[model samples]
Target: MLLTQYLFQADKPLKTTIRNYTEADFNELIDIQKECFPPPFPSDLWWSEDQLGSHIRHFPQGAICAEINGEIAGSITTLIITYKGQDHTWEEITDNGSIVTHDPHGNALYVVDISVRPKYRKTGLGKLLMQSLYHLVVELKLESVLGGSRMPGYERVKDKLTPEHYVESILNGERKDPVVTFLMKAGRTPVKLLPDYLDDPESANYGLLMEWKNPFFEKTK
Candidate 1:
């Protein structure tokens, strides 16, 4: 199944709240990673307690979560970075998911992961999470938000299309990829193609670099 495919229905309107993740949300986050990304996606890549600890320790505000009826249902992890204006793998920029390199004064908010419990997919919760991050960008006076997006739909078409053409097709509205399309809907624009960005076979080991610029940002002299 494609990532972000909504497969379950809730019995009632979800009472949701978005807030920065706390240390208490750690185990739920691990379960979320498993629900969002199952086997074939390496278990080792799941958010580790140490890495999650680093996020709260180094950049607490960048670690956001969504709660449904007081249950942690989704999360979006990020870090402040002095962007180099060049291509970098997820592992490189995210410091192998440890985010130990978080820069308190960096001008960019780099998203490391966005995981929604499988049941909450397509519930508008993802958009809420993204909007929270955008608000952070404005509040922090950051220039933009950046992240490498997984192209989970690539594997199906890789035999007949190059990654570039596949992505272009999605951008042109000729095709729709669940993950890429969701990110685009969340206001991110594709910037570059990152080869060997991860180990996911579904993405063909490729990631799309995406950005959302803050309109309120003022250039520092």
Candidate 2:
């Protein structure tokens, strides 16, 4: 399916056009990433322009960008992966590298990254990007979408609670975590808490494994 057609069909709140990533978007996206995730993040964790290009080359449709006023305001990078029904960690999937491990025949759409520029965030661009992912999942006939959710607000209470407990609090409404709350509101469920999932100081090096099943997906032999 054409990315343009999907964007036109999906419900969006802002005046934005969602399209596949391009080489020119590389620098803007890198700058946006820097703004969204501030310093203290390991330099090696950041994907170089070439690595971002590799993702676009491997999964063109999976690399989506939201354009607002002729500028790249947000982006979502994804890949297909065979999800084994077992406990998994982020490192096991990415091999602790910037390169994406996209499996074309995999059954699940694995979201590698999703970010909205700091200036444009909370303007509904993030939701639009997620809608693009939903459309992509339908287009690919994938069963579900999966990704790690950084608990950015965890550090405030990390000294008193375990990662699992922190996630439980968010799930049960006992506490509010920015990323976890966003994912839950987007129809994703927190399946597990992964320790040391990413090198983010804000999340205390932890992540919540989130999944959203495609209600319209049909399984075939």
Candidate 3:
């Protein structure tokens, strides 16, 4: 296998900066999410400044955006939800059983969602955005990143309010959906792909659970 690496600065054609999600960033984030996803969660749900509050909102200042030519090219949200890793919502069966864990080191970054504007797809911006998160992940000594995938028609028909084309764009890949690609490049692995994982029981779907590990730890043993 061949590995490729290059020098990169944020001032290229597709430049991006990671910063706090603010009231100003909310509209752009919403637009990007809606553009890239189908059957998008109601804008009202996201309009709130609550950090998934009252719930285990890892709203740990991990949400960020990719600005290309001074515009919002993409946006990403990372939050960790501690679950019974022994079991999952997918069809896969496991015996791990009722295991509970918290941010062992106090700062694991979990990837909730990542999105790229339709026009900016494939310019390697997504990878850059993904790589930026590592600075925080490693700084916090976090364990891994986590998130879910939308089935082709799951979002569209889940609420029966989404347009068919919008759903297809995200599910099937509009301009190379990089969720799977970037995750792999960043040393993350997909542990599951289950059917009907989302709310739409009728929709054929799969969920991807990915992990990003620290290479330093691998060499010590």
Candidate 4:
């Protein structure tokens, strides 16, 4: 499915399109990650070209990109996995980008990564990317969508509070965390707090375990 939206640039509406990922978008995907995420995190945490290609080949529908005037501005990569009934560390699921655990017939769609280029942020591209994934969840009859949300603003108050407290403050509106706030506003609920989730200092080495349940989920016994 193709989705189109308008993003304003100097009071002029620029056409933005959301479409499935293609093999040609590999380099731009890496470039966008560099632009959106801080150093080391992009290089240290992102999937390698071979891993990304493997994921796309396995679950093409879960990979998507947003473009404006032929430029790739944002992207979302996802995979399917059975729900692990306990708290999970990032390494346990992603396997350090090997993605060896991606289950094609799993019930939940896991958002491996989602990012928007710095210049295109706040132009609604991020929301569009997520919405595309949500629609995919519905189409595939999945139970929910899951992912870790980085608390980019956590470092500002890390010395004064724990990761849990920081998340609580943001949920209650006492603080505004860039990533958590955006995910919450987009209808994802914070289910748990992940400590040492990644190497990013901005997130205080923490993340929020989040999920968006599919409203149409039905049990088949």
* Among all candidates shown, the one with the greatest lDDT: 1
Candidate 4: lDDT over CA atoms? 0.83
Per-prediction backbone clash count? 0, 0, 0, 0
lDDT of 1 by residue, 36-65 (tens): 879877899889999999999998888888
TM-score of each: 0.92, 0.87, 0.60, 0.91
RMSD (Cα, Å) for all candidates, in order, is 4.6, 3.7, 9.1, 1.9
Model 4, range 1-221, lDDT digits (tens) per residue? 68888878667787999998788998888888778767755476555688778767777888789999999998888888898666676667766655667897898998878888998877777877888888999999999999988887888888899888888887788989888889887889999987788777888777788999999999799
Candidate 3 per-residue lDDT over residues 139-199, each given as its tens digit = 5555555544444444334564333333344445552233455566656665555444444
What lDDT score belongs to each candidate, Candidate 1 first? 0.87, 0.78, 0.51, 0.83
Segments in model 3 whose C-alpha atoms lie over 4 Å from true places: 1-12, 38-60, 89-107, 150-179, 194-196, 200-203, 217-221
In candidate 2, stretches whose alpha carbon ends up further than 4 angstroms from where it belongs are 1-14, 42-44, 95-100
Instruction: Locate the minimum summed-lDDT window of 10 residues in model 3.
Output: 91-100
Off by over 4 Å in 1: 1-11
Model 3, global lDDT = 0.51
